[model samples]
Structures are given as structure tokens and as C-alpha cells.
Target chain A: MRWKLIIDPVGRPGRDNMGLDSALLRSVQEGGPGSGGDAFLRLYRWDPSCLSFGRNEPATSRYDVEKIRALGLDTVRRPTGGRAVWHDAELTYAVAAPCHAFGSLRQTYLAIHQMLAGAFERLGVTTTLASRRSGRAPRPSAGACFALSAGGEIVVDDRKLVGSAQVRIGKAFLQHGSVLLENGQDVVSGVTMGTIPRVCATSLGEVLGRSIAFEEVARAIALEVRERWSGSWSEESRSPETIESDKFGDVSWTWRR
Target chain B: MSNIPDELRYTEEHEYVRSESDGVVTIGITDYAQGELGDIVYVDLPDVGTEVAKMDVFGTIEAVKAVSELFSPLTGEVVDINTALDGNPSLINQHPYEDGWMIKLRVQNLATIEELMSATDYAQHIGE
Candidate 1:
């Protein structure tokens, strides 16, 4: 199956990125699997450094509204379930495909993370997948995606590097993740009320002893996806601005929880 | 292996429905469903009196890794919801069939239950 690679070179607002991910998921769900409908790999960046909480996360309790307002950062709620993520100096990737492409939820997560790990390896960074420890619990109070590494997340030397989440509906699924390009963990921890465990977070710039361009990392990951999935890539012409206007930009969606 | 109660009917989506008095039925995810979901953090169910069609998404179950839509097994109106879940969403993971019951629906068509798989068939479906 040939997958469509949508590379948005321009940085967009948080709402538009979320909206585009949903649009891609809907396209696959309506098109069905193996019906000449292309799966999508979207690589994007966020402007003004937005903070996104999970669909079910209680942001009201975990974040201080006054502090968030003072920081002048954009905020939105993710359709996927997970903790909060601070999007700044990062490469955000979203993969929308037929659910059957990966048999179970866990399998789908591992598949994408593994592909990411391969891409990181190609870029000269060695990382491993986190093991699922039985009976481990998430501290919702922590209020940061990199505070803890869940099972199948990519980590370098026990420090989390990539945080991912998924939203599955009917026949299709969308899994999006954040790959930190620089050490922005302190900024994330300072804004949220909770004490984010900073020891577990790491970034590419910190690992490589120099800054990396967003385009360079995106190209490497895209190359890995092409080699791993055995598919061709093409750019999608239609903009997801319509979906942004209709859904993600709406206040109701950002604070629905 | 997950538990599959013989008295309840099941959907391929892993939702289970138990018939009640006067065309009403109780709905929740099966043991297999909850087990797969893994420590549900939140359950978003429709309020009482909302109408739903068969196979339509009625709600969502948010786990640590994913948020999955909950599909209604039969066309019906939500008559009751487990409000306790607002404070303690883990009930679904702890007791999927009993304390974790999601909602009660006044079924629109009693014959719709016939379309669901029998408990034995559901056990086979999950490879129990």
C-alpha cells in the first residue's frame, strides 16, 4: 500500500495541527483499507509553542490558568489519550492508517515507535523501547508527557525522547507523537503546577551536542518510514484549514473535558 | 483467559449487554475489552435520555495509551448511567461487568438482542 506523506513546511497554530490530524483520520476511515485510499504520514511544527493536554486529562486541576496566560503560550486538548505535552522546538508526526494494518492497539504503537527508533538510529542516536512494567500507574498530577515513559515509548539511556498517543475510531486510527529537538523540558515544567520529573526527559540537541534543523530530522524519519513500510510517498494538496475552522479552533473542543 | 458470562450477549466490538425487565438492557464492556483497554482513566458516556442508533458511537473509553469509541450494540435511549465513574473511573478495570456497568438503555427493539452473539460465541470470538 502506498502512503501519502504530507509535509507542512510552514509552522501552524496548535489548532490547525490537531485539526489536520483528525481530517487525515477521517479520510482513512471513510476510504476504508486497501481500496486505493492512501494512509497519511504528516510531519508538522507548532508556532508560538502550544501546550496540549490529553482528551480526558483534567487540565483545570493540573495547570494554573493564570500562569499559562502569563506565559503567553497557546493551549489545546488532544483527541488522543495521554498526559500533557509542550510543543516547542519539536517535530510532531502523525500517522493515520487503517486499524487492520496493525492488529491491536499495542502492536500499532510499537510498530510506529520502532520505526521512529530506526529513524533515530539512522540519525546517529541510539534509543530503545520502554518495557511495560506491570502495575505501573501514571501520575496525572505530573501534567507533563515526558515526566514518565509508558510502555513502547522511545527512550535514550532511560530518558524519554518521544511521547505518543492514539485515537482509534471504527476502521481507522491516528497516532501522533512529539520528538523533542532541544531541551525544552524546564519550560514545560515551569508552566504546569505539578513538579515534572525532569530526570527522565531528553532531546536530540542535548544528545548530539548541537542544534538540529527540523527539516533534517523530518527527512530522516520520512526515509525510515518509506524503507520500513515499503511504500511510495506523495504530497497532499488539500489544506486542512477547513477542519481547523470547523472543529479544533472551536473553544468547545479545546476545553471539552 | 477473560471471563465471558453465559447470560449476557456480546458484540464483535467487545461490548456486552444483559437483558433486564420491560425491554430494558444494561450495557458495559466485556472482561476482554477492559483487559485490553488497561487501566481506564475515564469513561465518557451519554447522559440519560439521549437516543442512539445501533452500531453508532455512544461514548469513549480513555485508557493510558488510547481513546477508543464505545459503540452502541442496539438502537435505544440511554435511561441511566453509572455516575460513580466520574470519581472512580477505575471501576471499569476492576469490575467490568458489575460495578463498572456503563449505562442502561430502554431498548428500541427487543429483537435487536438476537443480532448479538451468544456468550459461547463471544468466547470463541476472543479466542478464550
Candidate 2:
């Protein structure tokens, strides 16, 4: 039950985001159990929009270079599986644990996701476990990661509210997901899709019946993780050594399929 | 302490080849591959009657960890695919060597099985 969780709101720059996550994974793998003193949960965000693809996806799957340049959005690859996810108008969370520390990887994911389901339930957003059959089965909107909910994803009214992916190396697992709270079409699609294609998005505005602050969502997640795992937090940020290594910050690894 | 059963032949990519009397060879990922893959979530099994060449990508297995390509250990025609994996890919993680067996193939070249490592050699090869 011992863990160390840190919650911080990180600004954009696609390479930096990937760098932070990869560095955290490297730290836990090389640093052994309790890397950075304990298990961690980092909350972050992106600005100016970005399309991030899975680590192993071919580069051709990333973006149409001309389209991306025309749209003025950043495109990069994540060191995780799944499909392309658009980041903007959403809160992203990353949780890292020592291998086999939190039971099995499946259990840990289910536990946290179940907690999220409960939290959303409490928030009056009725949702169910988005199963793989539901996900793998063809949906009209099957092209995007966030548009379709996969097994272990949370869906409200048949639309995905959260999209997640996981990566494990040695004894470390990095699971990250995004929660939508507003229509970010302007930042995301570069143009509004009429009423923002509300089909694939559910915001706190819709859940709470009114607009909600971003901090409140982050706090709720922090409290959920803290309470579920019985952990305390600290205000320390990623070390300068890690940031300076430019390990993940490099465009090569960021864009490398 | 590893789970390389004495009866199965092995490939470097961790697929096991077991020859039956009818000249059909049952193939599946070895225990080591399943262990490294963690909990299997989805398995992309090749369709029956498809031809696959040695070292070619036959299909893929998506684990909670990552999605990895499954390589063919021999050139053969897939006579049967484990349909059970469509709903229970975790079978590979739960029983990689047996109930999780992925495909049964009509061997195009029986001699290739000889090129595969024996269980003891695979154990030694993977440093088990």
C-alpha cells in the first residue's frame, strides 16, 4: 500500500510531454522499487493541440504532414499502444507503479478505472465499462482513439468520456488517460464541428449540469488516487537532470515510430 | 524455474512447435513470451488456409503492456486457428503452452521443425 503520488498541471510542447512520461518510465525501471521515493501519479495538460500516436504505430499513421502544417497542430508519438488521441480540452493523468507491486497490471488498471467509474457516478454521469467487444465492433466513429471506447475504457451514453493506454517494461507500468471536460474543437479540430461533435465528448458542464473548474477535476482525481491507495503527496517536480537529458524531448524519439 | 515443457520444440521468438502424428504441427507462443507480454487482451490470429512463411509476421497479440507481432516459425498453411482466443486471448497468458495454443498448421516443409531448438536448448537459449 506504500506509494508516492505527485499531481501537477503541465503545459504543452509535445516533445516535453513524451519526454516526461518516458523519463518517468526509465526512472522506475532503472531506479527499482519506489523510484522517486514512491509510486507516482502525475496530472498534466497540453496547449495548442497535438495528435499523439502509439509508440509502435508506423510513422505514416501519425499525420498528413501537409494537413498538420496547415492546421498548426503538433503531432508526436507516445511510448504506449492504442491509436491517435487529440489532446486539448481534457485533463490527462499518468500513473506509474513498480511491477507486480499493485497486484497484477490488469487488477491495478481495473481498480483505478472502477474508482473512476464510481467517481463519475457520484458526479451524476452514469457510465459503464466500455468492453472490448463494444470497442472492437465497428462503430461509425472508429477512426480515432478518443472517439471509440476500448475495453477498460469508460463510456457514458455510448460515447467515450475517457480513453486510456498502458505500457509496461521490466517491473514498471505506465498507464495514462484523458478526461474530457469541455468542447475543445477549436483547439482540437482547428474548426468547430457545428456544435462540437458532442457525440464523442462529455464534459463536466454536461455532468454537473453546469461548468466546472479544471482544478476541481484534478483535485477529485488526486483525492481518488490518494484515498484508494492510501498515499500522501509532495510538491516536488521532475528533476532538472531528467529534463536536461533531453531523452524524450528529442524530436527523433517523439516522431519516431 | 521457467516453463519450457519437455515435449515442445521452440523458436527464438518464443513460439513452440509440437508435431502431431498426422503431420500437423500445433503452434503457440511459449510461456516466456506470455510472461513477458503480461495479461493478453486481444489476439489477432491468422485466418485458416492462409499461407505464412518462416520469420514472417503471422499476426499480433495485444497485451496490457504492448502489442507485439507473432512471427511464424515455419512455412505452412494455417489449417486451423484457435477461435477461443477471439473472446479469451488471456488464455495465452494463463496457459501459453496448452489451452492457449494459437494455430494448427499443415507443414509445407517438415524439415524446418528440425531447425527449431529443443526444449532444453530453448531453456538454455533464453537463459531460463
Candidate 3:
């Protein structure tokens, strides 16, 4: 349950952020368990409001790319799998570790969200996981992540507040996603090609009836991880890997699916 | 419990190798892997004729919760792939050993198949 904590005080571009996360996953994959550390947790935000697609998400045909570019939004495909998420007015968290450290994929997803729900409760906001009982899995046509809650997403009264995706490389894995502090789902809805498109998500600020800063939510989440796992947190920083950014910038990589 | 057919060989990573001829073998994820991965959504396999190194990642399997890498069990060339998986990946969950088979590799050395785990050893490897 030991982990490293990274908080990026200033917002960075989407490519740089994605690059660092991808690089961390590769490092953990190549280094194996207990090389640099067992796990890493990075809380960051995007500059100029980027829109990210999942690793294998059908973005080429499903998204309105011309409109996205015209609206002046940065775009990149995530190393993880899921759907689209608009990376603005939200706190993004990236975690990379050996696959066994988090157990299986579903177990890891559930465990992380459960901790997040606990974190939100500490911040005076109640959260629940959207499961089969809570809602239906999003139809294939659901383009934006927040448009529908998948089984393990964190939701507040049926509105998704956090959307995360995970990818495994050999023995290591990286899971990263957005925790909205403000409702930015509308922008995602507008850039998609779904016929009856609309964003069905809420934000921490909306739930708490007041705006919140990234630091406030970050502190609560960090405290939750420490208290629940009986773990210590070592601080880290983002250092871009050129190979990762170069791959991200390549058009073929973005439309790789 | 997960199925581990006695006729097939296995890798620690959960890929199963089934011989079809002197120099060719079929490959797929074991039933235990499909069970652990849950509902399958997509599979990305290398194109036919692609040379794959032993233990190298040859593709990825995207289940509902995450994307997992698929490693080659033997050094070979991809002779065939399951095109049906492109349209319906859940076949892996419903029938992991039969119709869900992922690829057919033309092995460089047929004897290498014996180096993999037998069903008994695989059963123990998974701590069954």
C-alpha cells in the first residue's frame, strides 16, 4: 500500500501530462515491483482545457474533430481504455504500479473508487458507485465518459463525478482520470456525434453548493489513501519523456485504434 | 474453478498453446484469464505474417474495466487471426478454448512447445 504523491501546482498541456503518465507506466513495467516505488499517485490539471479519448475509443468516427479544433481545444488519446473526458475544471489523478499490487482490473477499479467515495464523504459530500443496480452500462453509442456512468464510476445521486480508465503493459498498469470540481460535461457533449447527446455528470462544487480548489480535494484524497492503506506518501514531480510525447504527437498514435 | 484442458500447454502469463500440426499451433488466453478479465470488449492482434518474439507483447485485450497486453508464447510468425473477434469479443468469455482462439502461429521450432507448462503444471501454477 506504499505510494508516491505528486501534485502539479501549475496546469500543463495535455501532451506533457499524458507523456509523463505513459512514461511512468513504462518505467513501472520495465522496473517491476519495488524498483523506484511500488505505486505513484499524481494529481494534475490541464492548461487550455483539453479533451482526451480512451486508448481504444472510437474517436475518429465518433468525435467531431473539426469542431474540436475550431473550438481551440487540445486533444490526445489516453494510454488507458474508456471514453472521452474533457480535462478542464477538474482534478486529474494518475496512478502507476505493478498489476498485482492493485489485484485484478475490476478489483482495482472498485477499490480505488471506494477510496474516492470515502474521500468525498470526508469532504462533506456523499458518493456512491454506479453498479448494475444503480444504472445501466453505457450503450456503445455513448461517446463521452460522463454521458453515462459505467459500473464502477463514482456518482452522486446518479450523476457521474469521476471517470477513470486503466491500461496494463506486461506486469505493470496505469490508471488515470478526472474528478470534476466544476461541471464541464457540456463541452464533451458538444464535440461528440451522438444523436441525442448530453452530459450526465455532476461536480464536487455543485454537490457541496460551493466552489472547491484542486488542493482541497487533493489533500482529502491523500489523507484517505494514507489512513485506509496504512501507507506513507513520498512526493514526486513530472518529468516529460520525449519518446512518450513524440508518440502522443504522432497522428497515427492518436488514431491507433 | 477455471478450465484448464489437459490437451493444451500454457504460459505463466495465461496464454494457452495448442498444436495443430508439425510446425503450427493455436493460441488463446486460458479460461482463468477470461474469467479474471470479465466481459471482453475488444482485441487488437498483430497482422498476419508479423514475426513475434517469444514472450513479447503481440496484442492487447480490452475488457470492460481495463486493457491487458497479450504476450506471445513462442517465437513465430502469425499465420492467422480470429477475425470474428473483431465483431464479437465476448466469445472469449463464453468459449475461451474453442471459437475464442486468438491466433495461429507458425512456430520456428516445433519442439519448443514442450518447454511450456502442461495442464498439471499450469493447474499448480495458478494454485488450483
Candidate 4:
């Protein structure tokens, strides 16, 4: 198997990052089976901090609009489904591949998280994949992504360290996740009405008790993905700017729900 | 194993269709689909009177794990939507075939149902 590693050097707005992820998924789907239709692992960050809610999440009801506006943070609805996430001081990764490569949806989620856990291990941070708990469901009012760990999410000592979501388009799929690098969980919990205690989340810097560079973390994870999947890695040819205009830049798409 | 009622017809996407006498059919996700989705939190349903093409996405189902597109089983116009899902989407997890029916559509062609798989075939398709 061959894979492309897209290491975005600059931080982009929430919309462009999300748009590039979708564009990669579209490219793979259009390329069809084995016509340079290789898998992709993209690493990026959000500029100026942003709040992203799931496709079905009721934004007005869950988030405090006044507080969000005062903070000057951008808000966009994700094409994938999951709870809200505060994108700041974190390393975000998006994987676009064929559905058949990882079997079922749940299987694909676990596989990606397992590889991520391995990446954390290489960086001297131990993490585990959370399992489904047998209990009552959390309230819809719980808006924060790290408020509770869903099945196959990454956790460190039971504290959420990574949050992810997926959207499948026919034979292709895109799974994107945020790997916290610094502190921002309190801001997310405070801006939302949910009760996501700061203790419930952890970051790579917090775990290591030292600062970590985004480039270092991105390289380690990309190498781990190559080793785990036994694939050769190369830089992606196309830039994200090509698809930013009509897809992510449009207000209607960002707010479409 | 998930339930696959012999009387219902199924699509490759795991939606089941039950025909009515008035050339209409009720649609819902199969038990296997609900199991895979795991604790559904929200169901994005299409409005009544919306025309949907066969195999096209009509709406979405969001669970704790992921959001999945709901593919239409046949070409038709929606006549009714399960408004009960607005308040409680878990009906799909509790009773996918009964209380969780998604929509009722005035089908364009009855032959479309014939193109679908039977219960036994659906069972085989999901490896049940």
C-alpha cells in the first residue's frame, strides 16, 4: 500500500481545513480503485481558535453565542457527526481512505485509534482506546467533545486525549481527530453549557511536563502510520487552497445543518 | 444476530421497506444497522413531500460514534415522517422495525421492491 502525508505548515481557518479534508475524500473517490488512489494522512491546525459542532448538533441551544463572539472565535458545523470541539493548541489529523481497507465503520475507527495510540507510545505518552460503557446515554446538552469519551476514542488514565469523527461517502471514508497538545479544555467547557471538568481532558505537553512542537508530533505520527500500515509515504502534490473557495469559504456550507 | 423479518424487503445499505396496499411503503433501518450505529443521538429526517431517488441519501443518522447517511431504498415522494424521532432517536435502537420507522413514501414503481433482497438474502448479506 502507498500513502500520502500532507504536513500543512501554516495554521488555517476551520473552514479551509475542513474543506481540504473533504477535497481529499473526493479525490480518492474520483480516482476509483488503484489509479494512484492512495490513502492520505493530513496534519493541520486551526488559526485564531475555532469552535466546531457536529452536523446534527443544535448550535444555538448548546453554545453561548455571546461568549463565543466576545472571544472572537470562529464557529463552523462539521460535515462529520460528533459533539463540539475547540480547535486550538492541538494537532489535528485527517485520514482519507477506502472503506474496504478497514472493514466496518467501527473497525476503521478502532484501527485508526490503535495506530494513534502507538504513535503516543513512541512519544513516551501511554494511551488507551476507550470502550463503550453500559449505562444511560449522556444528555444532548453535553456539548464538549471531551466531556465524555466515546467508543474507540483515545484516553490517558481515563482522561480524554483525542476526539474524532467520521463521514463515509459510498466506497470512501474520512476520519479526522484532534490530538490535544496544550490546554484549552476549560475554555471549551466554559463557552458551552456542558460540564466538562478540566480534569477530564489531558494534553501531550501536560503528560510530558514539557512543551512539544507541532512539527515533531506530526512527524512522529506520520511515521507511525507508515510503519503500522506498511506503506510508503510521499508528500501530496495538490494544495488545500485549490478547494478552499467554493466549499469551505462559503458561509452557507459552514452553517449548513 | 439481528432480526430480519421475512415480510420486509431490504436494501444493501440496511434499510428495510414494507409495502402497503395503496402503493406506499414504510421505511426504516434494519436491526443490524441500529446495532452497528450503537446509541443513536439524532436522526436528520427529510421533510414530507420531498422526492428521493433510489440509492440517494435522504437524511442522516448520528450516533455517539459516527454520522451515517441514510440511503433511500426506492424512488418516491415522502408522504409521512416519524415525528416521534424528533424527541427520541433511541427508538431506532429499541425497536427499529416498529416504533422507529423513518418515513412513508408513495413509491414510483412497485418493481423496485422486487429488486431488493429478501430476508434470507439480507441475512446472508450481513453475514448473520
Give the top-scoring candidate (TM-score): 4
TM-score, candidate 2, first chain: 0.81
lDDT computed for candidate 1: 0.84
Clashing pairs in 1: none
| Candidate number achieving the greatest DockQ relative to the actual structure | 4
The DockQ values of the predictions, listed in order, are 0.58, 0.15, 0.48, 0.61
lDDT of 3 by residue, A1-257 (tens): 56777787788878778887887788787873344655778889999688888877888788887998799888888877777888889999888888887677778888788888888999999988887433223333357778776677899889889988888888888988899999977887787775746678999999999999999999998888777754667775644333377777677877665
Number of the top-ranking candidate, with lDDT as the measure? 1
Residue A3 lDDT (model 4): 82
Candidate 2 Cα errors over 4 Å, as ranges: A32-37, A59-62, A121-124, A134-142, A185-199, A231-241, A244-257, B1-6, B9-128
TM-score of each: 0.92, 0.65, 0.91, 0.93
Residue B103, model 2, lDDT:
93
Better of 2 and 4 by lDDT: 4
What DockQ results for candidate 4? 0.61
Model 2 error, position A135 (Å) = 9.0
lDDT per residue for candidate 2 within B1-128, as digits (tens), equals 66988888998778999898677999999888776555566677888899999988888776643655688899989999999987777778778877899999888989889999999899998777
lDDT of 1 at A133: 53
Each predicted model: what fraction of the native A–B Cα contacts (within 8 Å) does it retain?
Answer: 0.59, 0.14, 0.51, 0.51
The lDDT per prediction is: 0.84, 0.68, 0.83, 0.83
Model 3: runs farther than 4 Å from truth?
A: A32-35, A132-142, A237-243
Which parts of model 4 have CA positions greater than 4 angstroms off? A32-35, A194-199, A237-241, A245-247, A250-257
Task: Pick the winner on TM-score between candidates 2 and 3.
Answer: 3
